[model samples]
Target chain A: MKLTILFGGASFEHEISIVSAITLKEKLAGFDLKFVFCDSDHTFYLIEPAKMKAVTFSKGAYKKMPLLTLAQGSFVQKSMFSKIQHNNIVLNLIHGADGEDGTIAALFDFYSVKYIGPRVDACIFSYDKRYTKYLCEAIGVKYVKYEIIHKNEHCNITIPYPFIVKPASLGSSIGVSVVKDESELDYALDVAFEFDDTLIVEPFLEGVKEYNLAGYYANGTMHYSIVEEPKKEEFLDFEKKYMDFSRSEQVLQADVSEELTLRLKTNFEKVYQGLFEGALIRCDFFVFNNEVLLNEINPIPGSMANYLFEDFTASLEELASSLPHSKRPKVTYDYIHSISQAKGK
Target chain B: MKLTILFGGASFEHEISIVSAITLKEKLAGFDLKFVFCDSDHTFYLIEPAKMKAVTFSKGAYKKMPLLTLAQGSFVQKSMFSKIQHNNIVLNLIHGADGEDGTIAALFDFYSVKYIGPRVDACIFSYDKRYTKYLCEAIGVKYVKYEIIHKNEHCNITIPYPFIVKPASLGSSIGVSVVKDESELDYALDVAFEFDDTLIVEPFLEGVKEYNLAGYYANGTMHYSIVEEPKKEEFLDFEKKYMDFSRSEQVLQADVSEELTLRLKTNFEKVYQGLFEGALIRCDFFVFNNEVLLNEINPIPGSMANYLFEDFTASLEELASSLPHSKRPKVTYDYIHSISQAKGK
Candidate 1:
């Protein structure tokens, strides 16, 4: 089996994907790995494994190689003879537009290639904050009150002051801002618009502790990890998350009563059943006064969310091996031909 | 400006798309058209213009020509080394999975090509019945009560008898069955499962008149056509819709009240605003006892839904010309490079 790690996409989260890729390579060391790099311009490359350690967006770290593209239902080298066929699975690591938002997955689906993670539709639904909010609302889950703003529409700030403004489809807090007052709304909107045409503004929770659980689907069953609370000053901003070295020091198992745990578990199950059943999802919730408000769901969570699970490498190996691998189903066009022949002279 | 008509697809609606393509060629006769045919097996062909008239699934009607594939960020003819560059817009006519469900459009997006339809994310949401239902629910719209069943889960028949069973993601009623009793449920489930892994079972709306309207986004504004009610013996099944030539006689402009028209317009605006704001959407509604219930939204309707509009050709021309045509934005990797340069030492 040819397992390819696809990382670095056309998104603001490009650098973060590199960090995640480095960690993934270390964790999945037992497997024979092939690497495919998607550049920020959406070009794909089949990288040399010997130079994998030096690959980066930095001036001299990367080397341009033969391009890889899907042509006539087969993945092939651009020079036109070499094919990357034979039982391959893509371990997707692209985080934004072409990655987590379903574009890459959809491309893979178009070619009938197996890619690890959510189906294309699920990724599209989960990546967009507005759609996620709508999904939560439809499932009767409580979420932070938010207003969806389209790019061409005039700014309407119906939600009161001290709200968080975010691009609807970005990950890793790329274009997120905590707006303190009405005066700060336009600036926040501008920042978010740079990332995506759609934006979501939600009333900021003042003193709520953020609890998150990472879960995966294995052999038709959903397995969830123990909840952890990230101790941050406010929200985890981009700088504090990636640049600051002291970020993961205080990720403690969330302290809650058994009744609360039961409620959380039940809600998590409902969410998974309703929306993110096939892929590994990292769900974040705000808990204050025993009320849990669903914040967001990440379809391709960071580091494939390994840290959340005990025996992370072993569990991932099991999940990876269990993927239903097969060649693209040979579509029986016979039915179509039969119908056409019966109808047309 | 070069305009291409992309038709047929790797979907159950492949034949329907061919029919649509023939009609679209007549409807869009004024434009200089390039033709691309997607076979049922998902291979793309750049057919010679003179040979496009013979393109069909009928025995010996279709001819496979130069293979068109996206390479180095542009659509190209693989054998001839010819580039399909310079001011090209795809009038997408693919009706189902690889077409309307966003996979092909996402591929176009990946290559930064312009296509005349909804954006990829919008198409993904609108094509899937389950997601459309969830979006309607989130927006407080009245929809048929439905239960989603995933593959590998225990089959639960919670919806009352005389319900509709449908594959969650297929279009044109490909895998839809109206079950009148419990005995017919298993066969319906089997039929639905053959199409998709996810299924939606909804309580059937009895004694309801089905009204449909075609609309599109033009010049940043949504344009809607008058509602047309199809006089069907029962629900419009796949055979009656396509195989029966007498299907077009009974489509009448709905004899609705002024108040009903206003309500329909309002609801249509809300639905478009809340969900689809990109391409043309054909909305189906059930009207009975002065109540309106959304049935489903078709992202890529047949003949691009020209018959529903008053000045069909004029309206379609306007919408096509008003598409937001721009090159794919060049991504700036300077920030990523700067971060890598600072940290990767």
Candidate 2:
């Protein structure tokens, strides 16, 4: 079966996506593969699968791939991509903004292409922190209390001295700042306006424990790996995230205490569903005052979260080995068509 | 300024969109026009704005139209849409699924293109019924207790009889069915699944008074319109919606009581910001036992809700006059350079 890989979107996490895609492609290279990379310039290229490990776009037209656009699920190049046919499995390695969120999935749905990951609704629900909190409340999943502030509006109401500010719909910790007082609000707001109009002001959970989860949800049941405690602050600042890993205190794999692990795993699954009635998700949670409150859910976690799962000794390939060996069921258009007929009937 | 008349989409409401677009184009013909149409096959054409009124295709070469891909929002054929230069307004006329939701809005946001209606986050929140109910709850608006059923998941228990099941993310009451007994649950599930995999089951309010809202949130306050009563039995259906005049038993405008109208107007504006944070929205409410409970929020209401706002004496053109004026105040980024800087910085 033909499979296409889409990576490196117009998000702050674009380069890291290149690393993740190269890692995933290297793992899956023995199979028949067509590698496609999406760049920041709103275009895509079909590169040689072997060249994914190193830079090939050094010179010549093939080096710098022509721009590709998505019409539904199929990718269209104005000149080059228009000539290539679509693949059966379109693995999305794109992250942040349109890639990590449901926007890309919506295009996939439009093309009637079978893709790997969560549905559009769930993908969208998790990308934005505003709706993510609203949903967490509905499903009874514990999460931080946050107020969404629109820049066009004004409010000076203080939520204590320290609070985490984020551009509501962004990921990879872009434009996220931990504000200490009223004096810093303007700078934070200006930084936020660069990414999104809506801002999520969340009460900082002080002196809390934080953990990361890589989860798999297929056929309605949610599965996850052992939670890992990050050696970072409750909120990872942009500098700590990318430029300076030393800024983060340290990351330690917590002991899988039976009771605590069970509770954390259960809540992680519920939070996953809350974000979007999705098929797969990766969740982050903070444990404060003996309570595990969800932080965020990543629907299109990098290269299907190979790092988090493998680090926990639950490798994706191992999971793939144990699973029932069957191709992903071909989506049925008849199911969608019958409803159209029902409208007339 | 140049304008792109974006119409047609891959939604169940595709045909209805065609009808709406043709009507909108006929009325808006006096403006500079770029008629870009999306066919059922998902092919897009950019014709002479005037000639796009009817469904006409030229000799097999995708004539007079650019093969434009909606994702990332750029045209494949520059000559076809080169007429649509920078910073032009896009009068979005599509509805249902991705079109009605914020997926397209996010794309519009990526390129800094301003369109008519709410931002991506608000549009997405309003689309999901489950989330909309929570928005109502947050703003102190009432709602019936509702539970969701997963696709193909067995009936754990027939939700108490006399309940209504609807596809969670739809408008125009397309897949709504009132089930009175356990026997009807399967049929209802079968019907609802035709539209969506996730289904919402709410105990029906047998005698609730229904009210429809058509208002824009200019400066975060909603203007009023006399509510209209539908001429249908127990529940509103699709047939009554698209062709109401002939099928209705009785259709009349309801008089808003003085004290309650004042309360509703205040609360309506309150809820517009609280429940649906958008520039414009159409909400549905059910008043049970003299208490109004928000049932749903429509981010992109059909035909821009022309008929509901008709009695107010504002011509459709006047309703649309606000399109060009809405601007997304944002910072200009040297995007390519930013990609390089974002990676390094």
Candidate 3:
């Protein structure tokens, strides 16, 4: 089976997606890899593995590649009398809006393209910060108290001072702000509203221990990765997060009590089961007051969060083989035929 | 501007979508109309307006038409060096899974195609019955009390006998059952689970007054349709709902108290305010104990719910013109370029 890396989208995290794609080319060297780049203009191009470099995309040279169009279950390069089809299972590597935000998932599902990524509903739950809160509430998981504030409405800071504000539907800390007091609220709101129409505000807890766990469910069992406490100062802003995607080395696992680890794994399992089928995902949690609170869900994590798992390649293969297949109902058009015959049309 | 009617999908409601497409061809007769048919295999075809008949599709004649492919912002028929591009704004007329379940919305959005339909987030909220409950809870709207039951889990009828069992993610009455007694519970679960993995069970309210209202937000204001009290004996099953989509004549407005109408409109507004911005949607409500309880949200109503509005064509035109445009973020990739330069790659 061939693996197609689909990366780059019309998103704020487009560059980071490129970095992730290039990194994957090295990590998945053993596999028969095919590279497909979605430009910022949303055009699909078939890029050669040799040309899968950061500068190739940064210099806008990838456009000269063969243009690809999506058809039922395949990507095709159209010719005069026929088309060349690349019937490879796609690895959705695009991040942020078009990748993590149900766009790519929907597109693939509609076209019947087999892909290894978060399904549409999973993306809906994880992509939006507000929806994540609702997801937590539904699953009986704990999350930080946050209030949704839509743009063009009266802005009210009900979450108290020294809080964190983030655009509800964005990733990679693009439009996130740490507001200290009333003086910084307006500027932060302005920055966030530029990225999204709605915002999620939560209390900025100082000295909170944050842990990251990535996993996927396959072969009738849930496979988990070692939980790593992400090292950071205050928070990793957009630039720092962008740089972090380039790291390929495995990080040290977090040293925590077995009970706390079990709690984190349990919460992660609750979020992953049923909702996040067919994809590997990372959940960041904050241990506040001896309770695990979900911070965010990375549906399509950076570099697929390969460093977290001991055998990333083997895990991906298992996930790909055991991806949930949508049951196709028999569409005989029997009802329509009866209706037409009854009407004598 | 040219108007393209995209109908039929890999959904149970595919035939109904064809009926809706043919209905729209007549409804928007004054406009320059084009017909695009998505077969049950998820293949797109360009059908001539003259062949937009029920028999043409039921006989599988649409497969012989010109095959189309989707690209950036347009549908095209590719040749050796040039392609015929149909850069028309699309009217998403497909119903049920692939249509209303965020699939087509994400496809169109990712391709930058201009369309008049519910966006991705709106589809997510309205597509699944369980998610609809969460949406109502977030907005403080009243919905019927229910519990979700997964197919693999123990079949526990916690909602009592004489309840309604529905596939959580399916539209129409495809996999729905009205369980009147304990004996009917297993059969209902079996039927619903065949269509979807999860089921939402709610108390079957007898003699409930159900009202239907269709509307859209356009030109900085909300335009409502005449509230319709559908004439039904018990509930619309699959076959009854199937024939109902073929009705093109205007439905009569319900004769109710002005106070009741105001309450319905207010609740409808609350549901549609921010979530559903561009598309015309219909919300079914049950007036139980003088309170309006949301029954279901039809994101892409059949035949665009033309019978409810006085001037459906004019309303669609206004909505098409005033559709919310996604703000494209500037992708400078300046950060990536700086890092590359520093690393001397």
Best by the DockQ measure: 3
Best-to-worst TM-score order? 3, 1, 2
List model 3 lDDT by residue over A188-247, tens digit each.
Answer: 999999999999999998888999999999999999989999986887898899987876
Question: How well is each residue in B49-124 modelled by candidate 3, as lDDT tens digits?
Answer: 9998888988888888988878778888866778899888999988987889888888888877899999988999
Candidate 2 residue lDDT tens string, B58-81: 123335455654433444344533
Error of 1 at A6 (Å): 1.1
What lDDT is reached at residue A32 by model 1? 76
Full-model lDDT, candidate 3: 0.89
- Report, in order, each candidate's fnat: 0.40, 0.12, 0.73
lDDT of 1 by residue, A231-289 (tens): 66776788555543212222456787778766777777777764554467788888867
TM-score, second chain, candidate 3: 0.97
- The CAPRI class of candidate 1 is acceptable
Off by over 4 Å in 1: A53-55, A60-63, A71-75, A78-87, A151-158, A244-263, A274-278, A324-344, B49-56, B60-63, B72-74, B80-87, B150-159, B243-252, B274-278, B325-344
Listing candidates in order, what is each one's chain A TM-score?
0.86, 0.78, 0.97
- On lDDT, the candidate that comes out on top is 3
Q: Write the per-residue lDDT of candidate 1 for residues B129-175, one digit (tens) a residue.
A: 87777777767667777898888899887878899999998888888
Predicted structure 1: lDDT: 0.72
Interface root-mean-square deviation, each candidate = 3.5, 8.0, 1.4
